[model samples]
Target: MKKLTSIIVLSMAVAATETVNAQTVQKRYEENPFTLVYDGAITRNEKGKVNIHPITYQLNGITIAANIYTPANYEVSKKYPAVVVAHPNGGVKEQTAGLYAQKLAEAGYITIAADAAYQGASSGEPRHTDKPANRVEDIHGMADFIAQYKGVDANRLGVLGICGGGGYTLKAAQSDKRFKAVATLSMFNSGEVRRNGFQNSQLDTVQERLKQASDARSQEAAGGKIRYAGVASITDEEIARTPTDLYREGFVYYYRTYAHPNSSFLYPMSSLLDLMTWDATTNIDLINQPLLMMAGSKADTKYMTDEAFNKAKNAKNKELFLIEGATHIQTYWKPEYVSQAVNKLVSFYQNNL
Candidate 1:
């Protein structure tokens, strides 16, 4: 593992080659307003390099799909470093998770970005219902699968999460020391944020939250679908007034631009019930590995990331990186911004893992 100090900042140049991807992603969203579809697999064959192969594993006794990307130079004779990257809420591995995994894999790290249980390609009876015990288990489960891979070092395993996955990764790291290092990009403590917004300032009372979730459950039981109140697509009127609103930023990526229409996750409104029971900050004292938290300066959840970093204890190595001119959703699939975030991740893992 690497030390917490002596950092390096990598520069990303906008090359003409990147334009094709930009245009393709742009066109996909232009056609589909609700879904940000990817034209093809994010992990592809690079000829002289390796290809991203679709791999399946069982999670929760269901057949789940995962994309495993091995480095072009990977050989079965030796073990290599690996990272398990989880996607954001309402996202599939084909979107941001798969992209990060492929990029890191190309850089010589065996990367597996899997779809979480009950979402995307993973098997779950009730669609989109995420459980803390099971979801966190998903993170460690992926690590176990990677550890047994033919070329994995097993001892040098690491994990990463984006947004909601960010919070869950911490929970996974606390008990599952199998991971040598841990990092988060645009981290979101979903359990904390779902029950309360921005530092528990919005919903400070457990009774208030219980009322809402319970009411939603009752409505669902009455044969009505539980609806979501959070932001999905923000209008211009709302955006101009509250430009930094989480929903507004989410609209820019998940709906308008940089949105992958072909992604496979369904945003289940009822999952809030499960989320109401989840809280990653409750047991912050348990994490004992290296922790790297990355967030964008323009992101609203700066507090979410900060709050998590502050609560962490006994972590052998820790760091907090803030990227300029980016918001919460902007880091999801935005190439320019994600490049910076992923590079920090690569360097962090390189120096430590």
Candidate 2:
């Protein structure tokens, strides 16, 4: 009876702790008007310090919402290197992409992080459409806009994509010679995962999934109700029960700690029709520019990066940097890991850009 009582008390304590943590996170989210959830986020733009400019531009007839970060004491008369940052699938510019853009600005570079077409604050129909071609085009659109910004040195442009954005960046850099340097963090191949499942766990269900995606597309064509896939919301217990560190931590990060109203995991089910047939590594050797790919040393998604990195045979000055002692999601916000990544990125861009 004593042992049973102790166990029950422990369970209650754990539950109470989780409740407190969730409430704290909720309060933080509500307090930030910009919906910026990262640590040390800029509250207001000031001169002689890093400043953020929220701007929108028309991209292929869709309005693209982006945040451009200008360095401390920025002068439009003096040209500065610029980077176009691509966010992960289901991510908005206000999340990790914005954090990196802000950090890069502090390092004296002009950086722009934009919402993909049909996602975030950007304009599009059947929202959260996750297609490879559309994602790749979004990166191109960012480069097109930032290259024309007043203080940007268009010739010294670079691109950095995170997670699924990394996969699309690989695709974008293949044909867009405007990006002088290309880098990726925690690279995730959306095509491979959508078809094969994470870590290829659903190999046997490929055909079945493809058929379902095809049907979804057919329904859309017929003007039927649009369907969405992926997690809309999750419980703490569900998050704790998730087996993979990438997913379990991802749930807590996206739905709890770093939750934002505009950020979501849902994507149009019809999007799988385009995503399933695509691959980020196809013709990767076409990327002849300088390349840097970083991933957590212990990330389950590291294999995707490894496969893509190795296939970029023609890339100049190629490197694969592993952030020590980090899982895939940890690199997004953990201070130690984020610091390491930012430093490496600054060095890489300085040398190549």
Candidate 3:
């Protein structure tokens, strides 16, 4: 009985530690004036220094909440290269996307990161609809707004998409010529994963899942209760038991270390009707712009980036960069890994844009 008591005590202590750590992270976000969650986020916009501006605009009649970052010594009268950053699936602008945007701005470029429609701070009904078309449109919408922003040189525009955003970015860049240079980090093919399952683990359930998704759409059309897919919340125990490194680390990053109220993993079940039928690599040859794709060498999701990059036959000066000994989530916030990525990004943008 003494041994059992010791084990229980240890478990409780570990849980308590996790809770305190999560609270510390949450406190950081709540303290920021802009609700910026990333490390070193701007607390105030100052002249002659990198600044962040929270702005909103209409995209397909939906209000898109975005943060635009300007480099030090920015001037409205001078032309500057710009980059539109698309967030990962289930991520908001205040997370890794915002971190990257701020870093790019520090590197002497203007950058904007926006929440996807029906997600984060953006306005859309039947929230968290993860449609491929809508996500691709969000990237295009960013380009539309940033291209016209003061001091922006539209001709030198570039794009950086992370995770699921990376997949959508490929699709958007296929037709959106406004983006002169294209890049992706830890590209996740939502369609392929939703249809085939992570690592094809659910290939046997493909037809069954498709049927369920169809039924969900039908119910929605008939004004029935909306069904949602994915985890709305997860406990520490569940997170520890999650099998894949991609998912396990992702949960820790999104839900614990960088938790944001506006960020969630849920999506309308009906969204699978579109998501399962779409792919990021379709007509990938359409991307004729300079392309730079980066992924962690140790990430399980690296396969998706590899697959997409292989199909990008027509991308001008295409390159795939791998950060040594990094995982999918590490690229988001690990100081060393992030530094490596930001350095590479600055060099790529300078050379291409």
Candidate 4:
């Protein structure tokens, strides 16, 4: 009887902990419609000033959830420059993407940030699909939707992508001529990392991982069960023990301080089939629009930005700017770094857009 009671008590404690976590997340989300967790996020929309509009649209038969921010005193009759902001991998439209969109709106540009089809509040089945082609198409879909929006000048449309979205933006810009100028912040080459592994740390396991992904795909096709890769949750101790500042801070941003119920690191294991064979730097000469790529000077992922920038041979005008004394995730929410990035972006867009 003693052993049985101990097991019951332990299970009850675990369940209670989970319930509290869930409630906490719910309270945070309810605090703002934007659900923004970053410091200095606008909590309310003011009329005749920067305003946010929650919207939904269809993309390849899937419903996409998005937030569009219009500049102060926006008028449908007057044409204005516009930008499309793409969210990061395993990210929803509400986090850093929304933060940038709000900032750009304040700078007088109409900006829209949307949740990818299989993530966030967007519609999808067997959730958390993180395929590259779908992500690239999501950017295109945003351009299509936002171009027709009131007061937007389709001819002056620009694109700004963050993190993994940065990689997809590069690919989309290669074919989508609508984007007159393109910029990326803290660019993470999803394909390069997925294929070769982070900082080339998993080269030897490439074949083995590919086989695992293939098997997972087969199992999914056979309706056996779905498999997922990546972190769903982490303890504070695990985060403290993380070796790299990028991941260490990333865990805090995504899992705790800025935590959102919808945001997760999980992706279908089968996604590796496409991710392992792709490269963001491929067909490097196709980008003819002006490009501005920014990263933290101390970011571990700065190498990815450097590699992509060097290969953008055909960009009309290209520059790489570094935020001083900042790390990868730091660029996401740190006020000082975020201000630096936004100012550079404002100037870049003003000159080119």
Best by the lDDT measure: 3
Candidate with more favorable, higher TM-score: 2 or 4: 2
Give lDDT tens digits, candidate 1, residues 1-353. 13323222111222332455467667765654322253334323566585576788886586777878888867889789999998887677767777678778867899888877877767775666666776798898898789899899888898999888888898998888888889998888888777776556667675676677678778878988755545544344445466455666665455444555434334455566677778887787788888999999988888888888988867777999998888887777667887898789889888888
lDDT of each: 0.74, 0.92, 0.94, 0.91
- Tens-place lDDT per residue, model 2, 287-314, is 9999999999999999999999999999
State candidate 4's TM-score.
0.93
Would you list the clashing residue pairs of candidate 4? none
TM-score of each: 0.81, 0.94, 0.96, 0.93
Where model 1 places Cα greater than 4 Å from the true spot, the runs are: 1-43, 198-201, 204-209, 218-245, 261-270
Error of 3 at 164 (Å): 0.4
Positional deviation of 204 in candidate 1, in angstroms? 6.5
lDDT of 1: 0.74
lDDT of 4 by residue, 196-255 (tens): 988899999999999999999999999988999999888665777999887899987888
Return whichever of 2 and 4 wins on lDDT. 2
Q: CA shift at 129, candidate 2, in angstroms? A: 0.6
lDDT score of model 4?
0.91
lDDT sort, best first: 3, 2, 4, 1
TM-score of structure candidate 1:
0.81
Clashes of each: 10, 0, 0, 0
Which regions in candidate 2 have their CA more than 4 angstroms from the true location? 1-26
